[model samples]
Target: MPQRPLARALTALVAVLTAAVGAVAVPGAAQAAAAVNYVALGDSYSSGVGAGPYDLSTCLRSEKSYAPLWAAANRVTSFKFPACGGAVTSDVIDSQVSALSIGTTLVTITIGGNDAGFADVITSCRFGSTSSCTDAVNEAKAFATGELPGRLDRTYAAIRDRAPNARLIVLGYPRLFETGSCGLLAMSTYKRTILNEAADLLASVTAGRAAAAGATFADTRPYFAGHGVCAAAPWIRDVSGVIEAYHPNADGYRYGYLPALTAVTG
Candidate 1:
């Protein structure tokens, strides 16, 4: 409106606009960072239960789970932490999710162990006096052989619905039995039979579902070889530190999990 001010304003505007266009024209001018939205969904394994130092309340979530590990490894920008301990197929499918950010780019999941009640099966078999967890081990075999495929399918579909565009990766459970135990007081006979079958079942089932869902399935079974119940360099070290109880140790997680992650994120 004023004569002198109008002239100065026009001059300043021209300088600002010119600078902006110059910045754009420059090659490799430090582009904006890419946004990575990762969503995690699953049970205790995914939640990293018993990983220590993390706060695990009702759902028993963990900050050190493979989900976060992969996120950190790849430098994920955004995350929806929906994973919790004891989650199952039914919970994932039926529950209303509050944490998912729309248009998420990645997701990682692991389930079905709770469904199989595999932990209980292990305990029950161990508790038996005559046989060293043989009957329970057989049941684990059945779970791997029988129930795993369907569970994987159902869980994959649910994730697809929630984040259809996201790159989904489902993880297989680690082994829990040893092939050549001393036929000891709690774990013997059909040595490691239950864990043997479980590994196979989890790998096959998740791989199949991942194919159908247009996602990736990371096979950790091979990475964990010789690390089961009686393994010398067992990837999965139990709570007891001697006998294979459940869950992969820190070494197993890094070795068994990292490859799977790089497969998808890379």
Candidate 2:
């Protein structure tokens, strides 16, 4: 009952063709499922100012930042971290967007705080009288509600233009202080409340602008809720002598911002 020679030859040819087809198809499928090409861009928060042991000291790009953590965890194809310590909306439009391109499949940014004069506002609140602190907060709030929206619009638009295929994520700053006693910290409860309000306002404006630009907004407030600067297990730094003051610590990037980002990306 052995097969004829011609029949056996034809069957062997069919097997070879099937193997060749599978070889071609398998690689294509793998390419399609490959990891993303990610680019991280923005200001101090994005660059990991509060998280130490920076990989790029010029920009304060930390290996512990959410960007790097996510990149490593997900095993992305490429990761470009151009985020600096003090980038404003203008800086993103002018310099940071250069890192993006059609190949960039993911992008994350945290900006607008510097443009709102947040650092100066914090300085005023920390050192000046209650009236001065209130005035500073009011001024920053005005700018955030007024001129900051347009700037954010421009920044988001520029990013989209550069990385047309990227899923852009706009991350927000967390409320810096918890409204209570930190034994030696001089900030009043009123100051803490106003500052938190300012952060909320900034988040709202940034969220609205991000929606308009077709980008996703990731709010860090909820994640950092009980972990503000004065909390028992705080994630944000509390008036440290260095530039890291009022920013997220390493844990903040890992547990707070990282989780917020993961939720949105999923």
Candidate 3:
């Protein structure tokens, strides 16, 4: 119906005010979300020690590492790889945490194994007598239960302080041996059993500390089942070299560690 001029003017003004109110009600809805800034930090495991074709020789940073693979797959805004081989919790607190910042949205780490003297324990188990292997594993287990937690707490706290908003995922080591006999070269079943127990202890300690720090724990043990050093299709490398021995191979990173991480992140 034909309305008065004043009435039509008032109706137009009301429509404009309603549109203004709607704009004020929702803020930044039209703006895009922030991009993911991922920073990978920790020891060789995080640095991709076993995953070869390294991009950085010093840290053994490999393109095949779960960090890079995830970053590429997710198309993160930034990816920082500062994790070095043989890095302990101290090394991470001292050197690695520098890569993180408030903008970092995701962080992943595998540490505390070195602090527990992983290399020495493996060496003792491989070459020493069963008694020596047991002793070494016992000592490592003791240290892991005693001192490693504090170190991990410090490291995790440092990471949180640096990247306060990041979702930190702490990846754990798997049992290295499958037990039983695979060949003469394989260590004794007794040694294998103890070592697996030690790995379990470390995982427990690390998981507890991660929980204390409000971080997610990614356990790779399940994924690496039936894929230890003496398994038919082992993901962990046998003592082929000095550096790579007792470490996860490329396949381990791809199939085991990567999936474990993905499960937790999702």
TM-score of 1: 0.76
lDDT of 3 at 62: 86
Tens-place lDDT digits, model 3, residues 148-248 = 99999999999999999999999999999898677887888898899999999999999999999999999999999999999999999888978888888
Candidate 1, residue 231: Cα displacement in angstroms equals 3.2
Among all windows of 10 consecutive residues in model 2, the one with the lowest summed lDDT is 180-189
Give the alpha carbon lDDT tens digit for every residue of 84-128 in model 1: 777888887766233454588788878777777777766665555
Q: Could you tell me every candidate's TM-score relative to the true structure? A: 0.76, 0.88, 0.88
C-alpha lDDT of all candidate models, in order: 0.68, 0.92, 0.89
RMSD (CA, Å), candidate 2 to true, equals 3.9
Clash totals for all candidate models = 5, 0, 0
Order candidates by lDDT, high to low.
Answer: 2, 3, 1
* Residue 192's lDDT in candidate 1: 52
